[model samples]
Target chain A: MSMDFGFDMITEDEYQRQRALYEPLTEAVRRLIYASLHTDVGADAAAEARTKIEAVTALLETEQRASVPLVHENTGRPLAWANPAVGLRNAIAPPMVIHHEDDGSCWSEFTLSGAYEGPPGWVHGGICALVLDHLLGEAASEGLTQPKFTGTISLRYLRGTPLGPLRAEAFVERTEGVKTFARGYLKDADGATVEAEGVFIRPAWARDAG
Target chain B: MSMDFGFDMITEDEYQRQRALYEPLTEAVRRLIYASLHTDVGADAAAEARTKIEAVTALLETEQRASVPLVHENTGRPLAWANPAVGLRNAIAPPMVIHHEDDGSCWSEFTLSGAYEGPPGWVHGGICALVLDHLLGEAASEGLTQPKFTGTISLRYLRGTPLGPLRAEAFVERTEGVKTFARGYLKDADGATVEAEGVFIRPAWARDAG
Candidate 1:
């Protein structure tokens, strides 16, 4: 018996709603991250951004209710780990994603609220992992050299990946036999920050089988 | 109310049974992985191991189905993504792992069966991502590192990571403020094969409030 499962489609309106809800405050954090990497911004900057981000996210989430539908039970949403539905209880995220299709490159956005803070108020280290995982995974599966999942992934945080309105972009790098390689960057609004590379493998099961 | 979740301990027999059911095959694969990496042997050596691994794991699963419920729903085990019950019905694993205790490193493993085969008899690529995520996350959370998740990850698959009994190890290299920097390697019994690096962040949310 054969069946069709809907795995590749998500609406644009839903995307906008999520984006508005996340309200990422991207530009500010981007500039701040750039400075830290290029200049001797010190640890205080991460602390400052964490604090500023938490306050902003707190205001956005105040109106949110803990009781919400869990759209992601399995195929974990990228930011679902911290959703209020789960009680906004833990801000850390694992390497899952909420993918939206794009023509040229894969794009995704998520917000880091109080739950993700570090220092006096900054995004936590683990949260960065979740963000990158979601973004990179989505990138690997789409418009890339070939659809591969992470065989191995590496990251260099050049600087603290501040909290709040963050944006991440991923593009395919190259391919070899059953392996596909990719590179990506996460930025608030500043530019050229938090770089990463991932190996997407088309498991023996899914490969050629398609 | 203080609550105690009955997960902190396990019986010695249970440990042994678990090892018998899970570890030996993984070890065999690990040995092959090491050989594939350090020696002049081609990736085909790992391929040979995967075949042996699949045969062993299938028999183990059939033999232990009654004694050791490998499926998550049947056993009520928390890390269902790696459980066969979620129905990959194969040897490949998802990249997410939960129920990690204070082991200093969090890890999940599965012996690739025919179900995970990519080539005539190889494991799938996506499954590799699932394993690495579990490894790197565990490594970051180890000791004074404050258990941060992956902020960013980079992976280099020097060659096809053969499917078989495989071992992935991750450990912290250093830390920067609230972020822990770490690297991990996936090795077979012989030596190093796939290497990875990541930034583990202790999200702002998990910190104790003053």
Candidate 2:
């Protein structure tokens, strides 16, 4: 079933508690994922693991499945688990901490872990593109207004983004009707590593979807 | 430990089988990940799931943790489960089936599922970039010679890549010394949705690493 993600019905206090309850579960799942990457035991050992997994799966199945929402209702809250880029609940996510500004802009800071490595001692370029798309999209809507979709994004890689702490910033350049132009860049301690610009649009149907 | 991704040591046959065995495991994990996204039960229900998870984690701990390889060793086998673009072992992967041609070019076909959706009816722009980056990188190397790192990639979104089966192609345009220039585009049933050009380089250090 389709569900609305606009946080109009959720309160700040309720959102905080709801997020708090699931943090540990997502963290555990993330650990399991990274652990699995390194584990491929003997057939006997794997059989044992499978048995354990089956039990967990059975228990999860007993409960009613909550329809997964791709976008959070209250976009302002650092609903870390829901987001694919910075969501802590997701193991694949870099889980950057994002901050929104009043001037239709946003910034995020995070350390790219070994899990995100692509090249030798460098973060994956595709991952960088994912982060920028999310950053610019958030800036376009400030994660508070009608959702804006990424119409187009162009990126330039100045250098390899080293696998460590990095900062990224996005600012809206101009808005022509429903299309908002935004530019963003990522920087490691040394300086800028990647720069991007994109067109984000609030389609006519976005309001109807919410 | 630093490992070489050069596939020189692997045979085509072994590559094929290794991928086959792991495909199911990745598919199971993918299901688990999506399943987890939909399950946020009460504390009691979650505790049961956690207990079962702990049991599995304990069993896995008995063995030495495998060093996760970002890139597979046998790069040319079209190992559907090892690649981030087509690797079935990783749920985050798009699992494209790629066919490499003799003329130093490659093509991949896959569908953008609900998991990869960004806009209402389109694939994520970053996902397109990710696929293009991989497509072009594969074209640059063709899984044969020296490793080529993504030096720079520029993308222009012609239109939204509809969420369904799509094809992407990449071919080397020209090479100047270590620099290999490549171009790629993604297409749905209708026509091209995104186009990209990138420079892949056989870095001097890449030789040393391999």
Candidate 3:
């Protein structure tokens, strides 16, 4: 039904490192949003919020995660190796949890809210891009084997992305050297109306070792 | 200072031909948006809406009417062409436009409102994509005789795009046959923060005689 070749990516160790690095932040974002919504607490809680936020920021201070990346033994070439710093407190995270991480792809889910609205009662287009960027960013990493920055992305809005609760899905479509192609969609319960395709590149500045 | 490159396009005649051939819904959109805001007034009425709202559509219609597209010669190319089709009117204009011709660089702008809100006070991300897609789709067509579909688009969200009036700008950077590399950014009026950046493409399926 669609033209997709599926990307071939990194290794299990790299996957774990990426997950451990991002999951905490994702979890923190989820918690912060929940607290912001559920608690009737006022600005005085701003300090409390900082404390709570710090609970998660603590993860970044712990240690530096290393990734050897994938390599082709015969060619003696480093297969894929790239990582970029995606600073904490991501703008979009409907409380996503990294569910599974296989060799060449990663899967996660998040909900939407009033904070991300645009047309009438729909999610803002920028928020849609934010969600997809992260999804595609993860997908582009090919399940942590290599990390890449989006070189390009295309989006099709089939229907209005309603506000409130929505979901997004992203996965790798294919890979050629440092370039990784991916696709993602964001939708309300029914189906996708906002779809995106992206190409991610592992920049030359990134670490590389065979 | 910015990353967009829209200074160079092709001939005005080719622009006219390209415009004639384009099928974007811009005019329809202008009419729809005008009607929605000026609900009780007819197009014949001169001073209908309040300052910021009145003639908004007419002004757009005028600009749409006056703007000249750049189309390539033997290899007619520019940055986007739209052949808008007449369409139905409603509360808000739909964000759809057909691009006719391109020379690889240009800029596009559109405004949305509560009609596209998802959050209580924020705009929807999907709507952002809609506008961005239209602009990128236009950029994708640049420097080529015929237009192209989006092969990929990448977006970066630097901050939350506030609700109310906003603008989108897209232009091409370079071209490589079927692949045209381009970037765009969406900025709120204050300009303090950029909601997003986009890198879009023109697919091979859309290529025509150079």
Interface RMSD list for the candidates:
25.8, 3.2, 23.1
For every model in order, the fraction of real contacts preserved is: 0.09, 0.31, 0.07
Q: Write down the worst ten-residue block by lDDT for model 3 chain B.
A: B82-91
C-alpha root-mean-square deviation, candidate 1: 20.7
Badly placed stretches (over 4 Å) of model 2 are A1-8, A61-82, A204-210, B1-8, B11-21, B64-83, B162-164, B206-210
Docking class of 3: incorrect
B75-109 per-residue lDDT for model 2 (tens digits):
53333233445555555676777788888789988
| Clash pairs detected, candidate 2 | A7-A73, A38-B66, A80-A87, A80-A88, B81-B88, B86-B95, B86-B96
Candidate 2 Cα lDDT to native? 0.68
lDDT string, candidate 2, A79-119, tens digits: 43445576554545566677888776899998876455565
Q: Roughly what TM-score does model 1 have, to 2 decimal places?
A: 0.38
Can you tell me the DockQ of model 3? 0.04
The residue-by-residue lDDT of candidate 1 on A1-210, one tens digit each, is 121112323355654554333322222222222222122222343334334433333333334333222233233333222221111222112112344555545765666543334322344443454456546655666532233546666666666666577777777777688776777777876764567677677866567768
Off by over 4 Å in 3: A1-92, A101-103, B1-183, B186-210
Root mean square deviation (Cα) for candidate 3: 20.1
Q: Judging by DockQ against the true structure, name the best candidate.
A: 2
- Writing each residue's lDDT as its tens digit, candidate 3 over A83-138 gives 11121222222434443355545555555554344322455454566566656666
DockQ-sorted candidate list, best first: 2, 1, 3
